[model samples]
Target: MNKIHIIGLGLLGGSFGLAARRKFPELTITGFDISEKNLKDAEVLGIITEAKENPDSDTDIILLATPADSLGDILEKTLNEIGENTLVIDLGSTKSNLCARAGNHSKRKQYLAGHPIAGTEYSGPKAAFAELLDGKVMILCEMDKTDLHLKEKAYQLFEALNMKLRFMDPEEHDRHLAFVSHLSHVSSFMLGKTVLQKMEDDRNIFDMAGSGFASTVRLAKSSPSMWAPILTENKENILQALDGYISNLSSIRDLIAKSDGEKIHQELADINKIRDILDLGRG
Candidate 1:
């Protein structure tokens, strides 16, 4: 019976624990977390066999579910007690920094940096669900640094959870994710902030929020403590994406200001084609 240890039993980690336990009932999962409440919740929910305070527990796989900023320190600390066959993987948003930090370590071969392109606007053990990672893409970055055997183990684990796996270099992953994932978070947060400010003056405005607005603003409810470090970790790529987005907004603003319907129409026509490319069905 192989033992799997999850270092942080939050939504992502807890979901993994649940899926793994369901898929491989013989495997024992030991969860560790700083929060006693979170650990208690995970135990009550049957996400793990037990919750412990020490990271030195015996396990074949260690999943670090801490925030992006705390990954390096946690990885280093856990490496001290990890067995040579024990594979350690982090489910952090940004990868380049964590990859670089773990690359030169003596136990680098045991570490795999991964970002599962799946999550909800929630956190903690209570928010976990078995189907969270189903039909989602799981990106494995900097695989070259991880041992081949351990990489195979990771692939099998994610596959069992019904996730599609993709490989890419850490730098490329960070740059692409800044646009597809990180920027969406920022946009959602700002949209919520703007709408909340407006609602202060017009309380009834919130009642008018449609499905589109709700869909776009859903990520605004994400945990700030989890997101703040991710935004900061991939700051450079995020800033570049923001600059381009702001420039596009300025162009639209100029057209609206002059009432230039022709240019505005053309601009929207070009942008609307994205729906076709993205395969968004007709509303």
Candidate 2:
């Protein structure tokens, strides 16, 4: 059986373990996490064969699930410890910086940069489930840079999870995700913050919040530790996305201030086109 060592056994890594166990029974997933509780829970929950504090040199594959800020250092360290044939993949939110840092390593051929575009506001080992990756899109950035054989290993892992694969330039992936994914989280966080500030009493939010508010504010509950590095790593693209969102908000405020019902209706009608875009994405 092949031994796969998962470094940082949080939501993504734990979910991967569950998915891999269901798909590839022959592979043994050994999990390592900075949080001992997460590591132990992953093992006890049967997401992994065992919980480990570090990877063994004999492990055939290493999945880096640490926050993006620490991923580069962890990747370099793991590469140094593991064998030449071992495959390493990073499932980080932002790719450009992490990829660039690991790209220069002597064992770069053993590493692949990936972003699984699937997750919820919830986090940690408990939040992980086998179905999390099913039918999701996983972006493989700068695929040409990966060794052909190691790419095949990544493809096999992605295939096992039933994830659709898309390849792109690392920078392009970061830029596009900033607009669609990162910006939405920021908007949600701000919305939740503003509502909390206005209400003052937490009970008021729960008593009066509607389905729309709940859905819109859900991302605000996401882990700050995971998001902080992603925001900073993709700072340039996120700044651009933030500017566009702020501009739209300003325009809406102007319409509200003027009580321009007709223009407000037109603006909402234009935004309604997003439903079609969302429909096309459902596949």
- Among all candidates shown, the one with the greatest lDDT: 1
The candidate 2 region of ten consecutive residues with least summed lDDT is 201-210
Tens digit of lDDT per residue, candidate 1, span 54-135? 5444577899998888888999888877878889999999999888888778999999888898899999999999999988
Q: Any idea what lDDT model 2 has?
A: 0.87
Model 2, 246: alpha-carbon shift in Å?
0.6
lDDT of 2 at 230: 87
- lDDT for 24 in candidate 1 is 94
Model 2: colliding residue pairs: none
Cα lDDT tens digits for candidate 2, 106-225: 888888889999999988989999999999999998777778976777788889789999989999999999999999999999999898788776555455466688888999999999
Clashing pairs in 1: none
Candidate 2 wrongly placed segments (more than 4 Å):
201-211
| TM-score of each model, in listed order | 0.95, 0.95
Could you tell me the TM-score of candidate 1?
0.95
Tell me how far candidate 2 lies from the true structure as C-alpha RMSD in angstroms.
Answer: 1.6
